[model samples]
Target: MAGDPPTTPSSTQTGVPNNGNNPSPSEDPNNGNSPSSTDFASLPSATATGDINSTDKGLDGGAVAGVAVGCLIAGLIIGAIVMWLVFRAKGSRYTRRRRRSEDRGRLMHSTRDANLVALESSRKPMKLENFILQPAPDKEIISDLSRLDDIIRQHVETVYHFEPVDVKVTALAHSLTAIGYSERLSGLQVEDVATWCLQTETRCGALRHVLSHVLFSSIDWNSPGALTLLPQPAIGFLNSIRPIGEYRNNFDVMSFAWTRWRTLSALFLHPSPQERTPLEVSEDDIQGQVETLAKALDPVLRYFVAPDEESQHQQHDHLRVMIMETAKLGYTLFSHTSDWKFIYRDDSGKRCPVLCIGLEKLCGSDGYRLVSPQRIVEPRVMS
Candidate 1:
């Protein structure tokens, strides 16, 4: 090769350009046909890759955090709802229990109120008996006596005077004489006479008052004094009037009296000794005696006494024996008076026999023995 071209150094040996001062095509900066030093495939593009990875990581983290927070919020809501439901259920149960307890308490109170004790069986029976024997207040006695006088006056004017003026005068004189003679024979003071008159009038007035209001207008024709006449809410009230054993008898007595006295006046209707024939004098006297005996007995007997030998005869004998004994003592029997403590006293001290009986049956010794009205407790029901 040296002989052929006395040659210059090859480019590979000197690591320089074959042409002096000229760069090879691969190393020339201006060379368009040669490879450049920048290798896009081998050198990593760290800036762009790092930026993209950081952004993706940030997005993923945000998504995870959002999911966690959302789950936590959902769980909290569910827990709150469950707790609310549990508390509500507990509250409802507690309310039910409270209501049941209240109802039981009310029922017990009502039962206690309805159970009555007999006055005769009380611990202080003797005291109660003495109290019962005491006469009613003077104000009430005077009012009742005045009323009886008015009724007698009306009867004389309306019925006795219808026949003849002379008969009317005779009838008036006989009535006055009978009352006056009875008072004198009994050796009664003016107050005592007035009291006796009041007792008689009150006994008769009670029946008349009941008949005037209940029998004439309020009675059911098919079933007199039936409980159906009361309101539905008052069924319990009706049951509270008498004990289970005595309700029927008492109710029947009331009904019978109401009906019987509806057509009759409360005043006594009898023939005077002057009006009677000589043959009828003994019978008239006996009848007057019987009338006085009947008035002395318990007023309840007038309605409840049976006509059989077991009741009416025995009652009659007892009254007859009592009258005879009273006569033997020289204490005239006709003008005698007895106190009826079975009657109730209102705020004004007026006697209300029916109300007294009702209260005695309903409230027992608690109300009957006390001077005040009984207090009752009512039940509370949940809506």
Candidate 2:
């Protein structure tokens, strides 16, 4: 300690002299670099703001890191929501398609059931209005009428035999002469074939006998032979003609009914002979049809009798009864046509017969037509 020199800072700080012969000052051990008694203190307290600037810079770095992390998490959340919505839309579309498929299946099954019932009803010919149609959903059940016409034609051919044609044609001529029947032909009054045959008075063959009863001549009919045969036959023949209903509107049926329409029509144009009879037809053939239908229906209709009062107004309604009754016993209206003659016993026990024939004058553009039980009434023309 005695050899140690005095610290240099004491001299410089204190500006004290180190008298070589004098002793060291810490010699007193009282001072370090704490301060010199005569010097002022140097201090960093004036620049304390630099520490604040460094702290603010560190806080800004932490805030930026926090914002970047929050943005990344928010983006992940939005992305999840968008994916969920897309999946939801796909699921909804699937459900809608499945529901539609089920509905179509149900509709198909119901349609099949309705179709079956309609088809069965048509086969039985049930009341057309009541049957619900699924397949052929036509407004009118009667729209397809060709089938009905075919059925009626088949029935006619089945019933009428052809053998009676000649007898009917022969009988028609006799009744014509007995009655004064005339036709206006070529604008000149030409007597009909029937009239021509009967009044001829010339002792001649069968065909020529019809010719003499031409124009308007008195036919002296005898009580026996040809004249005698004309009466009941006349009634039968007259009953054969009937009024048919117009199921379809033909331009001709559309034309109002006028008297002796065909004869008047002939005046406008020289009608083809085919117009008088059907094409591919001879007088012999159509006359055959008349006799065939007449003979066949006579027995068939006669055999089908009416029910008693016990079952009065049963299955056959009054409408049907009137129609059928007229068909069977309604002879009072039947004595006018030329096909047969009518004979009746007036209470005098004598057979006084009146003669009538089919008036070519009354038949319309169509020739004589017959009505059957099941036939629909439409004015039937030769065509």
Candidate 3:
């Protein structure tokens, strides 16, 4: 022991053994001499773990943001494409509609031109002197027209139809005569007479109103063969001849009625050379229309004429004369003068106001003063 270096005693040599149950003071579990197996220094630092977790979260967030941006761009592209398609569709529809409207306009103009051409082709030339209108004598078969004359003469001098007083009187007299022959209407009521006179004047007024538009009666209604030759005014005159609601107002129907009116008007103005024979209109449509018109006007005639068949026949003859004279006078006035118009029912369907006692003759009176017109018997005439 003296020669050797000082050797620490082993646990066995020192007579105390290190075992599971006992240990030296330096190795004691309670002493702080040795490091323990569960020491806190052996674990990772808090800052280092937090840095790793933060890097993983950053990667995940970047992926989500990239996907969201890609979806937004795709949605915008799709919205733009849809808007383009919608506008293009609307534009195409509008173009198609405009083309159709243009086509309809061209068709209407062409149809009108064709009708005019056909009318001029098959017409015969005749002088107006062959079928001129004549005024009624003061004492022709009827004696009670004095009051009617007084009423007519007062307005005749005015520029109602812009005609001479004589012409107006002749036209109005023929119009009233056409209601029925003098003998047939002897038993009728005063109200009926007023009705007949008012209606005739109204029809005449309507004719003249349209005549003011188409004054070239010589170039216009020079022949009575075809309806196509007829001016629009002629068509309007025929349509207005019948009271409103009497027949269908279709163009074709009105054209047919015009043919009938023209034929009858011609016959009355110029009797057939044979006298007993029917007037010879070139178109078969005119002949058929004449018969049709007779039947159509029968109901109208029955209201004013006597029930006898002979009286009815005579009344139709007179009616034809009336229409012819009114047309003749209307043509004369429109051709010669420029200051007249018939005041039709207002757009609201109200009657025209009573302006002056000298111009308009009311159908009836309440005591001495006239009441508001229930019906526009004679439409007001004005300059």
Candidate 4:
């Protein structure tokens, strides 16, 4: 029975038929059936179903955006902290520099010579009450005086508004040109010039020097014989009776002395002297001479005074009264030479070389350092 041709299992016993070349119902491509287990096993993974039904939508867009925003916020916080630290460091440095400057200022004041303080304090303005006002030399004179005063006020305001480093070098070049030094001022940096001009003492000195140059410009300083700083008519009068060589040596000294003492007197004295000596010149004569000279010098004064008329008139009347008062004080000094000493001396009772020096030479020095050229507004009287 075991040798009865080893009967093959029927199709009912096995799921597949015994024919080796034939395909099963599941394996028939044209039958429209699913793959059999063998076909599925032949693929990459037998247990893996095609994509499982998942509720997770990977990486929500909102979450990605939130993470990016968080990163941006962190970056902003770091940047702000960095900026704050940088500014704080700069503030600390600025504080240290300020403290150093304060210390230096204290040292400077402590080491200053006592004479400088006394010298600064001794400069007193003449009281208008001391002298009676002479008649207006001329209506024209008053107008010119007003214009001059306006120019000074305008310059003060302009420079006040200008930043030290920011001020143009050319801003002062016209003034330099007025004094015939514009070329010399070439190539100078604006910052250096502005810093020098911005100093109160230096600014005042420069202005006074310019005034002196303009007022006494008619005088011939380059003459070979005794160099007289006095303008023509007064020069003729002072040289009319030539004093001894001692007085001759001091002619320039006296001229500078008289200039600082009486700025307006330069305008008051005629280019040619009258029959009367300075000692005999009456108040009425002085007033007449001042009016005449004022008419004559108007053109020259106008050029320097209002180089830029537009700017000068911009700020009107702020310092006009004060300037007028100073001008009045100057006019009072126009009386006979008998009222004021013609000799120049330092506070130490010695002759000041500065009085003998040219105004140009003196201009090179710090105005506060020179004692002879009194300021236009306030002349320093010896105590």
Candidate 5:
């Protein structure tokens, strides 16, 4: 449109002529300029051609570069949004998992609290049906030793009554050797361990003192009817209480103290199944038991009994009557501390008296139950 017009339509051929391969126009003298042309046949046989390529690509380089940059930007933006969504979902899942764990912990605590409250609300005073026999070691031997009958009745009862706490037999037994009594262990050692250490009365320390308690309560050494009498505690409780008339004006107080103590002691000792019953107890043993009981009771009985022998028949009769009353009172005092939980039995599966604090309060027919240490029995004497 400016200086030179565009070329017109022209016939073009890519092959060589059949005459021969034509030479370049500059190399041939006859091949001159093409200022004018009328027909294709009159044109020079050897004509040079300019390299020109035709294309329909109207899009500019700047436009194509822009398209490529835009495509690259779109891909990165989509990738970032997808990655953010994935990370957000994962974070939300972790938060839900953490919250679930905390909720489970809270639920468990709530359940435990509810159970404890229910148990406390259902607690009640124990009866015979709720009793169980699971005393601590101290109480175990205390009740067992009482079954020895005559050994305790004739002397130990005369002084210590049946109070194992007062006798401290195990402690007393241990003390025998400590008091300088080098007696080898033997069957007779129980009775003679104290006497062997007579020479070192001061060396006895707590040993002789414990022995003194046992001498009257275990060996029954203080009994007027005892076959063997040994060195007794110089300051025994019985010694202090035995003073008569003016010396023992306040002795009546001891009776009250003793009765209350015995009642308290009954709480710790439960009657087991007949088979599970720890010690074999019988009637002859009862007499010894009675005598042992009488030691503490006699002091009170003297308060009612006539001292003069002239009324001996009447006194004997009165004592016989009072003795029955005393036994009944003691039995009543002890029996109340427990109740019948099941049918009396001695075997493993038989009904037994269980401790009231645990499942002992429940019927054995129900199921096995756990023991509770918190459910304590009051066994100490109240002021």
Candidate 6:
């Protein structure tokens, strides 16, 4: 021990003695031999298998995300297609509903028109004797006469196809005759009679203008049969009337006769002459003529009923119907003159007013008063 280098125990000598089964330090588990083999096994291979596994996992995640995105897009496309189909279906249904509504409205209107024609055809003419009477008060008699006149007008309009210009003229003529009879019996100067005549003359002049314009414009003057049909009353009437540019006095005798002739000829020539195709009038045109004629007639009718309590109510109702009809036809009520005032006392005894032809007012205590014609009282004479 003294001579030897301090023999620190060799790792093999210091340790407990190794059994035969136990290996030396060079082969021990703690030595580099087994540990190197274990570490070599534990460490990653040159092939980098963990990195390959990580790359595979990343690829799998990307595929799943792509599938999710694709599903979302496909769902959106499907939803859009469904919405489009739904809206298109709704539009078609709405269109069909609108078409049905329009068709139903047209059918309803046609049915109503046909019913009106049937009713009008079945109605009888009104008798004038029921309303007009002699030896009555001026107010009562005028009211009755107005009612009779309106009934007659309505009857004529219903029965006749053409404008009832003659009917108004005839009614006016009867009223003039009645007034003349009243004047002789009562010795009362009903100045309203002269006013009525003047107004009627003005209306007749306007009606003549309208008729002449329509007839002349529509007639085929150059047709082969135009000259030969001299016996036809329409042609004769047109020839009798004054030309467009020439000035004629109101209430011309020829114009009155032509009005009557035109009415009769229209009645006789229902459906119109086949050769007179150019003169074929539309229903709208005829309706316009009727509306104009009604406008001319309204003032006269209002004048007669303006003084009566009972007839005023009836007049108002009739006027309302006329107004509604005129509105439907797109026409305005016009008067020949504007100075006359139709006055009626209200529930509060206040006067309601409407315009007429002269400054003459239809208001009085007895519901009857004389209306002076504008021409009758000269300004110089009055001054």
lDDT-best of 5 and 6 = 6
Which residue segments of model 2 deviate by more than 4 Å? 1-66, 86-90, 93-97, 117-383
From the highest lDDT down, the ranking of the candidates is: 4, 3, 6, 1, 5, 2
Clashing pairs in 3: none
Evaluation by TM-score, superior candidate among 3 and 5? 5
Task: Please give, for residues 278-347, the per-residue lDDT of candidate 5 as tens digits.
Answer: 2222334245444443353343223223346644445444333333333332233232222212111112
Candidate 4 lands at a TM-score of: 0.24
Pairs that clash in candidate 4: 233-271
Model 5 lDDT at residue 172: 47
Identify the candidate with maximal lDDT.
4
How many clashing residue pairs appear in each of the predictions shown? 0, 20, 0, 1, 17, 2
Measured over all alpha carbons after superposition, the RMSD of each candidate to the real structure, in angstroms, is 23.0, 23.7, 19.5, 28.6, 21.4, 24.0
lDDT of 6 at 185: 22
Superposition TM-score, candidate 6 onto the true structure: 0.26
**Each candidate's TM vs. the true structure?**
0.23, 0.23, 0.28, 0.24, 0.29, 0.26
Winner by TM-score between candidate 6 and candidate 1: 6
TM-score of model 1 vs. true structure: 0.23
* Global lDDT of each candidate: 0.35, 0.32, 0.38, 0.39, 0.34, 0.37
Question: Taking the tens digit of each residue's C-alpha lDDT, what string does model 3 give over 1-383?
Answer: 68999878876658675666766666667977676665556555756788898987765877889999999999999999999999999999999999999999998886666553333233663433233232222132022122322333332222133222222334443443442322221222323333423354443333222221111121233222222223334555645465423455564444433443444454453334324222322333333433443444343233334456776566566444333332333333222111112222232334222111111222221112134323322333322
Task: Score candidate 3 by lDDT.
Answer: 0.38
Off by over 4 Å in 3: 1-42, 45-54, 57-69, 119-383
Worst 10 residues of 2 by lDDT: 215-224
Which regions in candidate 4 have their CA more than 4 angstroms from the true location?
Answer: 1-160, 164-195, 198-311, 314-328, 339-383
Q: Pick out the ten consecutive residues of candidate 1 with the lowest summed lDDT.
A: 330-339
Per-residue alpha-carbon lDDT of candidate 1 for residues 1-383, written as tens digits (9 for 90 to 100): 55795778776667664674776656777877665667545346867788888887765777889999999999999999999999999999999999999999998876554432223333543222222112223344344333433442332222211111122324332432333222222222334322322343342333222212221111122212321221222233334554333547565444333222211111112133223211111233344543553453334233324446666666556544433322221111011122112111232222222211111112222112233433331111111
